[model samples]
Target: MKPLLFMILLILFLPWTLRAGDATLVSGTVKSITGHPFPKADVHICDSEDGRPDVSAQVDGKGNFTISTAFRGRAYIVITAPHHRPVGHAIFLYGQPTLAVDAVLETYLSGTHVDSIQIIGDFNRFEFDNGILMTPDQNGLYSASIPSPKKRTRYQIVIYESKGAGPRSDEVRSINGIQYDELEYDSAGDYRSVINTTAPTTTVSFDVSKLPIAQGTGYLKLMDARERDLVATMMSIEKTIYNFQNAFIAAGTGYEEHAKLHDSLNTLLDADVEAYAKQTDDFQRELMTLRMLSYVELSGSLDQQQVGKAIGFATSIPPSSIAWSAYPTALGTLLKASGGNADTRAYLERVATQNMAVDVRPAALYFLVGHAADHHDTLRQVTFFRQLVENHPYNHFTTSARLSYVPRTEIVVGKSLPAFTFPDFEQPKQSITGSSLKGKFVLIDLWATWCGPCVEERDSLLKLYRQFEGPQFQIVSISLDSDPQAVRNFRKNGPEMPWQHVHLPGVWKSPPAELFEVATLPKIIVVNPEGKIIGVTNGLKGAGVDRIVARAMGQ
Candidate 1:
């Protein structure tokens, strides 16, 4: 839907105010995974039919709540408890004066299913090998007694499962799973045990009957048929994806498995979301679009195929103004850094070059530029970088970075290095001006004591300086550490970096940092003897640094 139309429909969903006496009252008990009362849960009575104003209430410490809505008994309810997964979506309570809803939510560990349950947590220093296997009693019920830890412990349930010639998952549980859309919508907090429990705390039980989605009983009954079926499909998707991940992790490699799971997740975006979009008004679609941005990011490490699918999915979203504002920046990062395939590159090129997709163009322009840089396709890198700068001169993505702060064209090979200067770290009298380093190939090393990569590269940089520092070659290491003392301390305690040193010490805000537009480190800028730009790189280190500097020096 067009954003304008979406906004227009929102007016229809606005609530019609009524007196407090005529309000619909919703009362509920918030139950933890253990079937005990949970305090401080939030219940929201929403106009599910339309996106009207929601009446919300926070449960008291006793885990009971009563909330009144202006709507006359037609509403949808959502429940959230602190540090716990939320329950209720498509749980529309219609034409009821006063209603009672007892909600049951599970810990993060509850999602992982297994034939046998064992707990691994901070109590065991998160050691999977020494996990405490729960004892099964009857009807698939399991129980485990843990010696209470001094502080709250986070954990996950694992079972004995194995795949040959892979990490011994049975011996030490795997921390991998498929992230279904439902869980993505619901906040996934760290699985934490009850805080500061005293002695006589009852054994935490996993009664299969009481479990919500696990047993397909508790909360499913509350959801109407349509919602129940939708959720069931979502759950099934999660299980299939979960099994795929387990197999992938256990066997340690499964390209096809990864691709299939990736496609299944995307189906949630396409089939499920599209079907729902048709059912709801444009206002809800707008909200869904916003959520779609958040939803796309739910997965952990992506395979190349997965990355391609992700790009395709995000690119397909219609560019609404509000959605585009922050989306492009993230989208740009994704484009520039990840995915390698014909579809990925093809989609990116279209987005970048297509003037109509202004919001998306910034990112599409970004992907190919970085792809060129990664393969050392210097010509394409320069071409794409120039396009990125020219096409996005008045870029919209920078207006608010969800509220970040993009690209180096000025310092690319064949361009003249912009004039800049910085004061010496040890001596205020001495300055390392761009003009002073003339008639020599200069390596402007933008680094910091705090940057791990920068610190790690000190030895290699020192070697580079020693090998090439001559009348025709000079190396200037600029320190962007916030404090000059950190550099001094690092120099004193760590590897000897005996090159020409200049401290441009406001970090990124430092004068030379602005001149270079250095966003990441360790940044290496190589310039030839005549002072025209030689090359620029973000993480060109180890053997690559020597090669980069040597090529610039014509040796």
Candidate 2:
């Protein structure tokens, strides 16, 4: 009986002992490129999601620190120091009792005067003000440590100067030694930088100088070659189509020439798709697919037979192909060009019902639902949105469909302008309110400095402003920049619109934007003398702006 009791007790305690031993001790040393230790550098061990530090410690004057935690899965270590770029690394703690990491810090030198630096990222929801400050050393290097309660793989370091130094500017720079998407911009117009701590390190390096190309022409040369090749092929097709169209117009016939040109283009597109399908790289295949779709759109109108052929071509690509996402847009364009025939509808229905990839099915369904919405078929729109939400409850499309059901504050024509108060970009203390612009025909331009389209539209906006620069008309240019300095920079260096500019630093989530449901930028809302919204459009192309201003001024 004594032996049996002992055996049971041992079994019960063994599991507890094993669990207790799973706790990990993570230690690291941070040094600068100059071989100097980062004294009192901020070291954070964070949870993978929330970015809250679980265990934190400071590097001593010798640049050494240690943290012990019960975390048994993946986590992140973030190191920040003054004058040095913030460093983050993803680490896994399973099957290890202790782990040591040695990091070499790089300095932040963007040829700008920076009074302070802080680290911010997705782990903390990218809140600019909720940044972790770094302490600067005598040598101009800074360091700090915080306990990381979550794990994250990406972050950005913001360098800020003093507030009164010509608009309180801040510069966000990418972390070195990491590859990130060049086109990933946040709502605030800040570029996103990614760090892959999960990937294995490779030490292979190659010299590009040995290649038969000029120093700066490596990527440019490749881009030029691609552009030339595409343009040559497109021009050849364009010449044939041009001649065919001219002949058809002159003779009031020649359908055979049109058919031949269409067939030839289709054949070329098919061959390109087949070649792209053979590529091992998914991104390359997707690029080729996009090129082919562009070719189709530019070729000409598609008849019933050609529409069927295009749909067949799209469906021929396997659901597993990465190029599948491109098909929805291609199919939607073809359907629109084909005037939405029953055959096209059936093809879309087949895609939606098929056992396709998770992404493909919802995309097909979304196109159909979007088509219904475009036609103002409210009943069909609601029904399809409901179906999407019910069938794919966890899909991203379902979330969008759910939001579509929510009642939004309509800023439509004949409605009163939503009341808002924002500070002037040049003078933050002075407020600009909706009531102040009463009795004036206001062109309320909601825009951001970093938006390329918005910047391009500046020329058109200035032309309108100059055309109607009187007491009856005013251009209230509202900037959606998070950093006030960005607006100031644009005002000083970019186009001088000479209009009443307002700056409210919330970007897309600003009060005015949220109230008006301003999802896309360069949104222009024209208000009459009665302070009622008269015209709202996402674009201000051609003489449309002049006509709107003229109508508003009662010209």
Candidate 3:
């Protein structure tokens, strides 16, 4: 289930309209499928199927709601109580005497077929416990009911049995009639419990460890909780897709089974996520998959026609959707590949104009800046930046306005490298300008000490640098470290590589940082001898970076 905080934040921007008429009195109580009354549940009435609000209320302590408002047409009513599954039903709102309806919520459970399973998942928004307990019925079936709870939820069931009877309170639990280490429920743990959507059986597996555990002995500890149902199963699979997508892009190989599962899970996830459209996690996963698919073409592994098809698929995504952080990242890649074509630019422009709940405007602005810079369209960048700065004057992103849109005159790519100066490691002033290296290919690696991915790729950069080292090929490294001591430490203790290196002082506010739109670390930019920009790539680690360097250097 989406976090309440996240959902509230998303709803902050929902459009609302006021309507008046002869009032119709509607009252109802929210109940779970198991016949439990829901308390403090939100009740909403919308005039349209798209959920345009007409009137809303919250269930009282007695799980009852009363909405007296004027209406002319039919409206849809929705019930969402905390910690329970959400319920939706239609209401006929007219100048009538009264309207009454009963809303029922489904019982939330992690999975089926566990002797004693601990529940964990997104339902409690990853909280270890939301107090959703399952008890076996007379028919030998485990069941629990939650009243009209929040809209979306993802939950997991961990079954625990007793191996030996020492005391009622023991940490280690049993599985399959055997006892082993209790399931470690760490809030920060990397494992996300996945349930089998295809079957009633609750399947538990961790991403960090592929080992499958079942319910049995002592007391089972469950980790990872969300709203219970098929939604949780779909979220788990979406996460799997994202993981595999990243793995494939990094390794330049495909995982067929994972991909198939990803597609299969996406069908259910799409409907579930859209039904509860206020969350960004699902959007994040989808955008990531789209970006990964784009990489299959951007890496030159696929032809331009293939790239076009991918872009078409990307454009097919709904327009109102925003990906928070991933939105800009995806936009950047698409712009680079499609050169801001009509369809692609339309999407970019829409994102730029939309009211983003997250701080994704900066990324959108940066993509536009990059596009304007690449095309030398100063007017576009200037207009966009000015609008951004003016509209969001107090926004944190405004600080980078100057660097976001640089003067075209100062940025020359094809001629001898522009005259630019950066501070040396010893503060002795080291510089690289057009006059110094007029006829050599230079690869600039914009990195920082604090970035783990940057550090991991250091060896690959070194190897790529060494491979192309000659009169025509050179490598320059720039560090965006706030503390000079940190850069010095990295220089002394980090990967040992012989290359011209300099630190630009501030961490992210450095001049070059905003100028180059270095949102994340480890940015690689290829420049010809004359300083003509060739290619720019980021998030390249290990062999991924190696391949980029090799292809760039014609090796």
Q: Which ranges in model 2 have alpha carbons more than 4 Å from their true place? A: 1-286, 291-320, 324-371, 392-407, 450-452, 538-550
Report the lDDT tens digits of candidate 3 across residue range 390-440. Answer: 655544445445544444343333433445666555546666554565577
Q: Which stretches of candidate 3 lie over 4 Å from their true place?
A: 1-307, 322-326, 355-362, 394-401, 408-444, 448-474, 481-506, 509-555
RMSD per prediction, one decimal? 17.7, 17.9, 17.0
User: What tens-digit string does per-residue lDDT give for candidate 1 at 1-555?
Assistant: 112322233322223111233444667677776555653466765442244325667788777789865443113466765434455543322234665667776642343344566765556765556878879886677777666554432444554433345334223322212211111111121223343455532255555444233222224134234334333433443354345434333332334654565565565556535554474554334334433333344333334453444455455544432233223434544444344556556656665544243445555555566567677788876777677565555442222111112335576788888887667776878887888888888888888865545654666777777887668877788888777876777666566667788886577778877787676678888888788887787756668888888877677
- Worst 10 contiguous positions by lDDT, candidate 1: 178-187
Maximum-TM-score candidate: 2
Cα lDDT of candidate 2 equals 0.55
Against the true structure, candidate 2 reaches a TM-score of 0.45
lDDT of 1 at 50: 40
**TM-score for candidate 3, residues paired by index:** 0.38
Q: Model 1: residues >4 Å from true position, as ranges?
A: 1-339, 342-369, 372-412
Q: Rank the candidates by lDDT, best first.
A: 2, 1, 3
**Model 3 misses residue 230 by how many Å?**
15
Identify the superior model by lDDT, candidate 1 or candidate 2: 2
* lDDT over C-alpha atoms for residue 525 of model 1: 88
Q: What lDDT does model 3 reach?
A: 0.50
What's the lDDT for candidate 1? 0.53
